[model samples]
Target: MAYEAKTKATDSSVLEFIENVESAKKREDAYQLVDIFTEVTGYEAKMWGPSIIGFGTYHYKYASGHEGDAPLAGFSPRKAKISLYFATEDTSREELLQQLGKHEAAKACVYINKVADINVAILKTLISQSVSFLQERYPNHN
Candidate 1:
């Protein structure tokens, strides 16, 4: 059987999702992220799964034969923090994260309390770099 990805893009409204965020600050930050991500990636926002607002899409197949389609860049406004999703394989992400301001780094996600806590410029660079890296790595997907 083929591996199935739980987080698939849906036709759900991105704005609606943002508006539903429990925290007013996170809601506002989500709106700002929509603008920043759309502008930087040149892709409109789309809802991925339940919470993520994603831009662009890429299909990836690993050596193990597991494959799935995912957004090139995306974020989620959770209760405690905003989770920023970027390309994990990008070489420049580590250096860029250092300048990202107050944020917690996971393997592929960066968690920020709010947009005000981070450098927007660095975030833009990270988004651009992630898109570029994914496009390069998975040329056919983009």
Candidate 2:
């Protein structure tokens, strides 16, 4: 059987999701991120699964034959921290993260307390680079 990704894109309203964020600061930051991501990626925001607000899409198939579609760039406003999703394998991601200000790095996600704590310019670069990397790696998705 073909595998399916749990975090598929949904028709849910992005603005509604932002408005529903429990923390007012996170809600406000989410709106700002939406604007930044949309402007940088030149793609409108779409809700991915329950919480993620994503821009653009890419389909990836690994050697193991597991494949799924994922957003080129995205973020989520969680209760404790905001999670920024990007191309994990991007070469420059680590170097850029050093300049991202206060943030925690996971394998594919960067967690920030708030937008005010990070450099917006770096975030834009990250978003752009992520989109470029994914588009290059998965040309058909572009």
Candidate 3:
């Protein structure tokens, strides 16, 4: 199957979605993320697709011609881990991750077993840096 982007903001209730998290621990972590992201970005949380909670917004068009809007920062509390979305292309991402506590990072996502396992201060820095990088690159964030 072709890849389809699953990260789009919807009118879905973020609070209700978090409430439905299967694990109590995950649900608590989701609430903490909402508070953290909101405080860091000064933007309200929005439900992205069925799983992700996102903050802020930015639009971009790639050289290959693809174009769309995406959240400046976001996270999803999956059954196994909480997936954090960040601008990993930023040069400082690696340095930040080194201090982020236990995490598994792919190209753009950081997977952590729980929020308690990570440094909240470093998470805030990551979110701030990602927003700054996106704002600089996209210039259409809000």
lDDT of candidates 1 onward, in order: 0.93, 0.93, 0.90
Worst 10 residues of 3 by lDDT: 1-10
Per-residue lDDT of 1-142 in model 2, one digit per residue for the tens? 8878999999999999999998888988999999999999999999999999999999999999999999999999999899999884546888899999999998989999999999999999999999998999999895
lDDT of 3: 0.90
Candidate 3 off by > 4 Å: 1-5
Residue-by-residue lDDT tens digits, candidate 1, 49-140: 99889999999989999999999999999998899999945467888999999999999899999999999999999999989989999998
Arranged by lDDT with the best first, the candidates are 1, 2, 3
List model 3 lDDT by residue over 33-103, tens digit each.
99999999889999888888889999988887777889999999998899999784656898999999999
lDDT winner between 1 and 3, please give it.
Answer: 1
Q: Report the Cα lDDT for residue 106, model 1.
A: 93
For candidate 1, give the lDDT of residue 137.
Answer: 91
Alpha-carbon shift of residue 135 in model 1 (angstroms): 0.3
